[model samples]
Target: MISEATQAVITHYERRHEFRGDVFGAQPYANYGYWARPDLTLEQASEALTDLVAASAGLGQGDKVLDVGCGYGAGAVKFVKRYDVDAVTGIDVTPVRIASGQDYIAEHSVADRITLQEGDATAMSFGDESFHKVVSVECAFHFDTREAFLKEAARVLVPGGTLALTDIIPRRGVDPSAYLTGETTNQSQVCLDMPANAYDADVYADLLRSTGFEAVRIESLLEWTRIPFADALARVAAASEGERAEQISRMATRIRQLIELGEDYVLVTARRS
Candidate 1:
């Protein structure tokens, strides 16, 4: 039972998936990846970000993991192969992403270890205490109300299980409420869709605690993720031509604007209490 807001997000992704694929490549990741090194390629940086999130979640062999907003199942497949996780269940609202993820899983020969389904994150169907850990990479901000997804994560995670994700939040002194009222300028549609209450890290931590999580840790990855990603986009825009290049240039400009506006890209981790 996807809510209308969630459906709108699905539609947004479906419409932009092709353009995103062109920009991010065929590797099945849609994220502002952690650029660990200045020379890393986009795919490499994306994998690095996935590894960072997995490490933050303390993934272990035989762990059952759930990936919310798992785009194209790349993170799920990586978790299985890299950490030897017993199984990974990935859920995303966009049907096209699920279909592509199925193909990716089949190609990787990990069909038994990874499952991708079209489902709403804020209202998942999994039973309580269903997973050992939950991880989302760079997509949680798109959840209708990130707090709702946090509650769902708490419900599905085993007691003491971990949750880790990367998200975008407004820095102190910025009013996320303005986003709700359409007062913010130059914001991408996706940013505009983020619930106002999710804009601040302190509020985010409080929401997590209230939703049954503890020991929350939020680290800004602005330098590693957003800055590098914008740099890469600028390089791409310069090297490429035509509409794709124009799109890349626009995205680069948007990222720069976000940076100036004090938008923070953060990695947050917590445990179900």
Candidate 2:
């Protein structure tokens, strides 16, 4: 149900991302944000690859942009620097993440061009067709409902605008309950992805079409994460063949695990009709 508590945990972790601590135990992404991750350097390469591949998506200068579930604002920074986007606004339901995102913007000296706020996906306060481009990075799955999220996204997009979403989706009928929510937390209240979610590539295409979007494009390159994960593990293994041989083997195991566990963090881009 994407309860407020689960959102709180996400938000809290982001706040601690800049610090060296652990609050969510040994969760995967619970490590020190991407910046502090042992794999950040390689991960950035992956993001750059995606940026280059999608560079022609037309995020022009002076465009008003909205980033849903901005999460520490890494992608927002990438967009401003790579795409010439003028003004970027990132909104999340978590105050901690909002604060952390804002801090990241200020630290990077992009405060004038970027902003972060706490917002609800089902109901944004922006005017009709307020943004020229809307993008979410691996975060839209947290929206209240797939339909409501798309509807509100459409409401905030102008004619000929675009919505590029990179979110985690379900695989098949696999019960995500064991992986999603945890003790003292219940995200199932709103997480639509279940036992088996095929990243909803087709479903999102259909929803975008129904919500006044045209030229929908769905790319299900789910192995991108594994590429970086394996690369990072290789780096770890390279440090010391004997010392890291076992660790590298574990990393390889983990990369395969990412492929098996998260085969749904897909990228879907839809243009507003």
Clashes of each: 0, 15
Put down candidate 2 lDDT per residue, 5-40, tens digits, no spaces. 346545544544543122222211221122223435
Q: How far off is residue 183 in model 1, in Å?
A: 9.0
Residue lDDT tens for model 1, 1-273: 666666667777787776774667768888889998999888888989999999999998989999998888989999998899999999988899999999999999999999899888888899999999999988788787788889999999999999999998888778665444443223225424556345678888889999999999999999999999999989988998897788789879877876786688999999999
Off by over 4 Å in 1: 177-192
| TM-score for each candidate, following the candidate numbering | 0.93, 0.70
Report lDDT (Cα) of residue 209, candidate 2. 91
Report the error of model 2 at residue 13, Å: 3.4
